[model samples]
Target: MAITSANQLELLQTAEAVAREKMIDPELVVEAMEESLARAAKSRYGSELDIRVSIDRKTGKATFTRVRTVVDEVENHFTELTVEEAKPFKEDAAVGDELIDEVPPVEMGRIAAQSAKQVILQKVREAERDRQFEEFQDRAGTIINGVVKREEYGNVIVDIGRGEGVLRRNEKIGRESYRPNDRIRCYIKDVRRETRGPQIFLSRTAPEFMAELFKMEVPEIYDGIIEIKAVARDPGSRAKIAVISYDSSIDPVGACVGMRGSRVQAVVNELQGEKIDIIPWNEDAPTFLVNALQPAEVTKVVLDEEAERIEVVVPDEQLSLAIGRRGQNVRLASQLTGLDIDILTEEEESARRQAEFAERTKIFMDTLDLDEFFAQLLVSEGFTSLEEVAYVEQDELLVIDGVDEATAQELQARARDYLDEQNKLALEKAKELGVEQSLIDFEGLTPQMLVALGEDGVKTLDDFATCADWELAGGWTTVNGERVKDDGVLESFDVSLEEAQNMVMTARLQLGWVTIEELEAKAAADAEAVAESIAEAEEAGA
Candidate 1:
């Protein structure tokens, strides 16, 4: 192309050297200047003429000059450089490469200088973008030292090494104020390129911020002597960390904690005194889970390894402490441990009651053909005696499984037979034991009296034979929803048929008490014992 002879090429050469000193590749600098000078040429000499800028690849040297053909009469002056001006360059140079007395470096009045300045500024900005992008993009998520540049709308602008970063409003520490030019460190959240420049995001509130502090304070973590498995944080409140060691002898938590908590205290001070739980991690699911639930002593951790879940059973008082206020502690624990944890409590009253009812149940199995599930149901419902279901009629017994009307009737028959046998055996056993045995034991009377005493809350032979005694009396009782007592109830047990009237007279006169039921029961018990003796004798005769 036709070249301009009177250009300022020295300025382009100087700019390249400055770029190399700044760690920028000289070739990249040359390319930038070439494009910028082309833009400047376009603005200076419009589209009517051809202008080109070239840089020597080896020297990173740039030359910006205009090229135009020599025509007889220049219709467009910028497009035609005269032939006399082309004489100094190659005499053999054709129309394209011919030289001319190029435009002199006389200061452009207004437009050209402005155009040149725009070119330099645009080129510099693009160069800076490339430089910053390469430097900081790889450094994302790393900690960096920066100086506070300004604060706007709660966001702080920091000048980190390569570019300015915006520390967003929310990530700032509570109630803390930062002034211009204040030195600080932060986590690099993001690095992005924009029209203006590279935009970097910074954070001071990330839990990784705490982990970083540990790395700085504890050499073991950086050197790989310890490892951090996880961290969970409630920025202004509490945090939990799960840690493990690379070396068997090293305790990851203790290393992070330092002697007497010095290292942890340093981190705490950095966090403005937020509580930290440094927990040791375990490959054993149960043990790891126990450590995750800090402060609360875990008696047991039942882990469902396949489901990745755990049930933490703690004492009743530890329940709240384990769960924390509103479940904050457990929530962080879940985050740190990677296990879903549920908590449970055991009560003594329920346990003792269960044992008591379980013992009552073996006898039931000996007689009833109920399934384990139904047996458990019965136990749960407090039904330990055959008498509980014994008096139940067909409809009530039908409510229990495996018992139809026939079965229910059979159950009632068995219950009655067992009761009868128990009564006979009771007297014989009493005779054998000699605790409360005598022919006078049969001094009670009546079958209905016996049934009522045995099945209708009578509970004892005394309740049957002495129902109307002084001890069985009450001063006031509800009858038809009204409180009333006959005053002679205390002497009701003194009833006798031989002196029925006299006994009544004696009871009413002396003690104002008598019970016909008691006198009857005493006679019946006496007769029951004699019947048992005769049956035994007959069986012996057989």
Candidate 2:
């Protein structure tokens, strides 16, 4: 079939119809049609010739032409023409002017028709995928309604209006099943273009799914009077939402719950009976944790800011309730508060308090050559270590019971004497073990740490670089008859995990260890190099 002037209207109508049906820009369809015609023209004009096609948007006219550049010297006969031969196409043509040769329409044979069809179909499909990707990309992290199209290996395929979204197996709620054609709501987790087409990933078990549901059900949240600070969900079981109010007049939790439990109840119903707890959000983590552990009363909360951990003491009767089945309650609370939580009964807390008191009292007695009575008095006054007593103001020590001016002076002197004696001993031992003075004088490293590392033959920065923070700090060590401290092998460096990792990272950075990103990039580069070497070897043998 030939594209004639009489049929140009029909061609434009066909392009417009396909554009409307596919929901793509009409211009894109016209461009695709032009591309298909160009492919057909290539068969008539040699494949090496620069044949082009364009359809006039207003006139619905298709123009096909061969493009040749006017050149000083003729090279390829199909692409370049000398200035002398180009005068017929353009009267005042220069050496750089592009000449166009108007070509009459030729009837497309069977093979050419088939080629045009494939070209049109491929271009239209690409345009559709691009349009779908753009439409859904902005909808990521939003809830969308769809019908279950099919199931493949536990993954549910949902038919959203404009495109298909895959609810991956791991993203589905536990124990939830969907039949074909069943209506479902899912969160649009991601929208991306891949080899086949645009892929929209959906999720039903995401914490964001529950948060979006609350935004839909609660007017205050939707209006921005209340904000969702965090969400933790155990899909199909229980979930917790932390909400805060910008307007002091409105209570965040109550606003989310609605009158007679109507607002939150709607969210709960949508989650397949997942129990929702609306807790008031607070800048204070302990207060937020107390509220998060609702239905069970908390007696006390001890926070370790350095460790990012909390210890919550509950009454013996409330222990099981605070922990929940399989420790889910505390786990969710931890997630909501962004702190590690350890739940303990009041009795357990008291025992731990006593144990700490004994440990502090022993440290003072051992370090300062103090009697049990004086050590116990110092511990009672909140003096945990000899360094605190040594560095504390004399006035502060005098405030303590039974600590007169002379007694305070004597205590400070003894504490300083003990520290100096210990430092001297550490220096002697370090010298004997060939420990570097630079490591010994490092700011964060203690004298004991240096001595320990020296004994272990980790004397230089390079030697220390080869060791993990746990190893440098010492994890399991023995002293005398019994364990002086069970926290660390060095008996003193009871570093938290964050501190340990920082110490290792610091050492590595100083010693030229690869960063996390650099490590990954290096691994990729090495893999590519190896693949190339193998390809070269294979080619050599071939």
The superposed Cα distance between candidate 2 and the true structure at residue 97, in angstroms, equals 2.5
> How good is model 2 by TM-score?
0.83
> How big is the positional error of residue 415 in model 2, measured in Å on the Cα after superposition?
2.5
Lowest lDDT sum, 10 consecutive residues, model 1, at 433-442
Cα-based lDDT for every prediction:
0.68, 0.85
Q: What does the lDDT read for residue 2 in candidate 1?
A: 20
* Stretches > 4 Å off in candidate 2: 71-75, 82-95, 437-446, 452-542
Q: For candidate 1, report its TM-score.
A: 0.55
Question: What TM-score goes with each of the models?
Answer: 0.55, 0.83
Q: After superposition, how far is residue 290 of candidate 2 from its true place, in Å?
A: 0.8
lDDT of 2 at 219: 86
